[model samples]
Target: MKRSEFIGEFDLDAVLTELSVDLDIRVTRRMLAGACIGSNPEDAYLSARELRESLEWIHEGENEGKVKLTTILSTACDDFQRCLYYCVAGKGVVTMLDDLVWLEKLLEARGRIAGHIYRNKLPVKPLVNPYVAAEPDGPLGRFDPSFAIGASWSHDPGPDYDSDDRGPGPKLKG
Candidate 1:
């Protein structure tokens, strides 16, 4: 994506395809911003196409869940709008955490996914594996792993999450 364009302009598929070539890292639609909840229409559509190109990746297991946030630059509809996006990643796949109300009410999705940000970054660990659950191999190629297969996974949501003296990272309430 160009520095001048809004996130809403491009689809996630297109960006991921271009990004895969540019970053040398495989990007799945599950992580693309527009493909999930509260997504920009354009970005979501583009993501589908990008996913079609690279169809041979598998999910990697994890002790904690991870989600890939698509840079909010493309999802912003206005030229001057900029925002942070949240997503779910685990089991080798990254997708939108649409169910979380954080984005709907203009809240942060990090705390909802994890308990708090007491540790530098809030831990939004998933309870289960959320990977694509499949793979396609290329000649002389390898199958990449994925993450976060479904909504059943999560992080700790107990009293430890709400400690006031947790440090300098962003804090989240249960």
Candidate 2:
């Protein structure tokens, strides 16, 4: 199945939510960010290792009655493992590098599938700046420019202003 189709078929958000609620563990964006690793062989190895370790940790917690795992959670974990497997082989070497032509293809596929699962599944909200007002819609908002004023200075030069003045007041002595 296509990567998007595969992602759509599984309710990853529900699985993660179920795990978090049952385990009473907070799953923040930072935790799920680990899934984005694997740019290189070593990174991919580490990412897979981390996922495996996480699964083992969860299993241990389940066994100790500290956490609970439903079938869906288990399946989701297994799917993640499979996704990691495609990026690097058992010995931590990329599988398709021998044929340089196909390496890019493999990497692209791996990234697309894993990225969709990791990024699209997470419950992360975009951070908003409270001090700034959101731009309105339409061309006016799009064309508007923002400016920062350091200090206010009067262009009129008050009552002492002269239209043909060569300088503003007298130059300060050093």
Candidate 3:
């Protein structure tokens, strides 16, 4: 299960500790909180605790099926990289980021998680619609490559989408 969903009700620090234990990674909350672009992190508090709680709620509200090993690796890594954004979100700071550092860290975390999945032989399954960015769409059909929303991603589509936009979504732009 994803950190967001597995323990969404926990705080970011709690969740981070869980992930560190669960995924065998070494990440400092200070670093994670500092990663927040706008979070002052009051004494570097970096509400990792709050993040875990919220994500737990989010995940509990939408947990179902077995999260595929490959899928989890793919998405969890994405989250690890995107962890900074989530931290900001947890801190009630709304901002945008398209950086590669998160991706790299995410990939690294994925590699580590992959080892666990291999040892456990878990099946790849859908957790939920991951956060994706759409491009910018001008007044016309220029399209925003950073669009991150979707339609009916509540469940995977059955071979009807013209493209892999996750769910059956129309032409959308950020």
Models 1 onward score TM values of 0.18, 0.18, 0.20
Instruction: Tell me the lDDT of candidate 1.
Output: 0.28
* Residue lDDT tens for model 2, 37-152: 32332333344454444334432433322122122123422243334323322211111122111223333454455566567674323222222222322222111112221121
Question: How many residue pairs of model 1 clash at the backbone?
Answer: 39
- Residue-level lDDT tens digits of model 3 in 63-157: 32112212222342224333543332322111111112332343344445544654665543322222343221222222232323233223332
Worst 10 residues of 1 by lDDT: 63-72
- Over the stretch 119-169, how does candidate 1's per-residue lDDT look in tens digits? 434332222212232221222222123433344233323221333344697
**Candidate 2 overall lDDT versus native:** 0.31
Better-scoring candidate (lDDT), 1 or 2: 2
What's the lDDT for all of these models? 0.28, 0.31, 0.31
Give the range of the ten consecutive residues with the poorest summed lDDT in model 2. Answer: 141-150
- Superposed on all Cα atoms, the candidates' RMSDs to the truth, in angstroms, are 18.5, 27.7, 19.5
